[model samples]
Target: MFKDRTEAGRLLAERLKKYRNDPGIVLAVPRGGVPLAYFVAKELGYPIELILTKKIGHPTNKEYAIGAANLSDYFIIHPGAVSEDYIQQELFVIRTRLKEMYKKFMGNKTPENIAGKTVIIIDDGMATGNTMLGTLNLIRQGQPGKIIIGVPVSSKEAVEMLSKEVNEVVVLLSPEAFYGVGAFYEDFKQISDEEVIFYLSQLQKPS
Candidate 1:
């Protein structure tokens, strides 16, 4: 496992320095993504901001993501995991929770203004690929000139799936025996909504 998220980000940023002066923006999938994106943004000289989205949890187990939501008021439900009837039944609840989470986690951030820009979506890592997929659908709405998915590490399947979703996918590792995203990181603390907002508000302050 990597020493920590920062170290992993440093390694990933090296691979992304080609975009240092290129026309691009970094959209982080918080709250874990915030840290990784922060370091990468600093390295590559790009603006970083949170891309708001939420997991559409299973009807019975909220921990399990059946799909996810995008900022355009759209949800990406996993076609293989749940039936159409089941997803249709839970659509309303999913949308409601997603909006609530957007407000709670994203604060006053606006996801617009990315029209025709090259947007790079950053996450600490990917496990199921649902989160990255959901966030990608949202980013695609802005009609970016280019779209890239950057992660420190990911499962082989996640990397493969994400590769098809964006113009470019940059991952440090695609371990075959990956059990989860945290498996690749030594420090995998649970990031809270408050922590996400705090980092944004604190780091953005004028020096």
Candidate 2:
């Protein structure tokens, strides 16, 4: 078990030391991933950017994710599982929120281009990997030279699911009897938008 997201990020950064100073950018899955990604970016001397994406939850059971969507693109793991109307509605709502988040955190700055550059995607943890699968599909459109996923802990299923898609999956723990992401952390707290802004601001400061 890790102490918190900060420690988890530091350890993940240690494993990713070979990529330090490489022509790569860190894409953090907010708002939980920001803190962890901040530490990793600091350790690797890379710029940090937010990869804004949210899961498209099933209509019947909102907790179950059928796919994921960003502002421009989306991925559906189970195409016929949900209705077209539902997907469209979810996409609109999710994109609207993502736009607000992007504006809030980045102000008027444009997103970084990842073409021909190594892209390291960081998150607190993965559960079913459905959401991440959706994220990967969108990231692929950017034509990155290589894609890597860094997480502190994940379920065995999540690791297996993501391993086949990305160039590499760096994980600290993949327990067979997997529990939710927060269960492994002693100080797991919901990250607020204010905290997200703070971390991003810190990343922008001169070293």
Candidate 3:
């Protein structure tokens, strides 16, 4: 288990050393992945961007992700799992949340373009990988030159599922007995909006 997200990020950065100073953008899953992406972007001297995708959950079981969507696009990962009305409602709610989060995280700065650029998607960890898959699908719309998955830890199934969809996968650990993402981290605290803003501010300062 990692001491914390910072340590996990540092170790993950070492594995991604080859990409240092390359033409790429790191798109981190917000809140949890921001801290980890900060380290990778800082290490590689690349800019860090946020991939704002929210899961469209099932009507009966909120925990069950039927699909995922961003501002411009939405995908129903599980066919006929959720109704059109549910998806529409969730999409509207998610868009509102995404706007608030984007404003809080980056203020007026527009998101970086991914076309013709190597895209590194970073997250603290993954369990089912559905959310990340949704993010990837959205990113695909941008037609990135390459897509890479970077995570500190993930389940075996998640790794396999992601490996086929992306150009490369860099995961620190993928244990067979994986219970949850937090189980692999010693100090997996809930990341706050202020913390996310702080990291973004630090990264944008003139070097």
Candidate 4:
């Protein structure tokens, strides 16, 4: 078990030492991932950017992710699982919210180009990995030189599912019993938007 997200981030940064100062970008999954990514990005000497993607939940079961979408692209695991109308509607709503989030966190700054550069995606943990699969599809559109997933803890199934899609999966813990992500942490408090902004701002400061 981790003392908290800070400890997890430091440990993850150590594991990623080989990539220190590599020409790459560190993408955080927002909120929870920002803290971890801050440490990792600082250690690796890479810029930190948010990967703004949200899951398109199944109609009946909103908790079950049918796909994931960003502003420019989307990917559905089960093509015929949902109707085109529903997908379009979700696209509008999700993109609208994403635009707002981007504006809030990034203001008018242009997003960094990831093409031909190593892309390391970081999150606090992974559960089912469906959302992450969708995220991978979106990231591929950028044609990064490599794709890596870094997480503090994850279920065995999640690691297995995600490993196939990315060049590498760096996970600190994968317990066989497989409890939820928060279970592995002594303090897993929900990260707030202000905290996210705080971390991002710190990265923007002159070193």
The candidate that achieves the highest TM-score relative to the unseen native structure? 4
Location of the lowest summed lDDT over 10 successive residues in candidate 1: 69-78
Worst 10 residues of 3 by lDDT: 78-87
Residue-wise C-alpha lDDT for candidate 4, range 1-207, written one tens digit per residue: 999999999999999878875689999998899999999999998999999999999999988999999999999999998999999999999999999999999998899999998899999999999999999999999999999999999999999988999899999999999879999999999999999999999999997
Global lDDT scores for all candidate models:
0.76, 0.91, 0.88, 0.94
* lDDT per residue as tens, model 2, 15-96: 9878886788999998889999998888888889999889899998888888888888898888998789999999999999
lDDT of 2: 0.91
lDDT of 1 by residue, 65-170 (tens): 7666653455655666766777665666666766787778656666547777778888888887876776677667778888988898888888888888788899
User: Highest lDDT: which candidate?
Assistant: 4
**Residue-pair clashes, model 1:** 0
TM-score attained by model 3: 0.97
All candidates: TM-score: 0.81, 0.96, 0.97, 0.98
Task: Let me know the TM-score candidate 1 reaches against the reference structure.
Answer: 0.81
> Candidate 4, 118: how far from true, in Å?
0.9
* Best first by TM-score, ranked: 4, 3, 2, 1
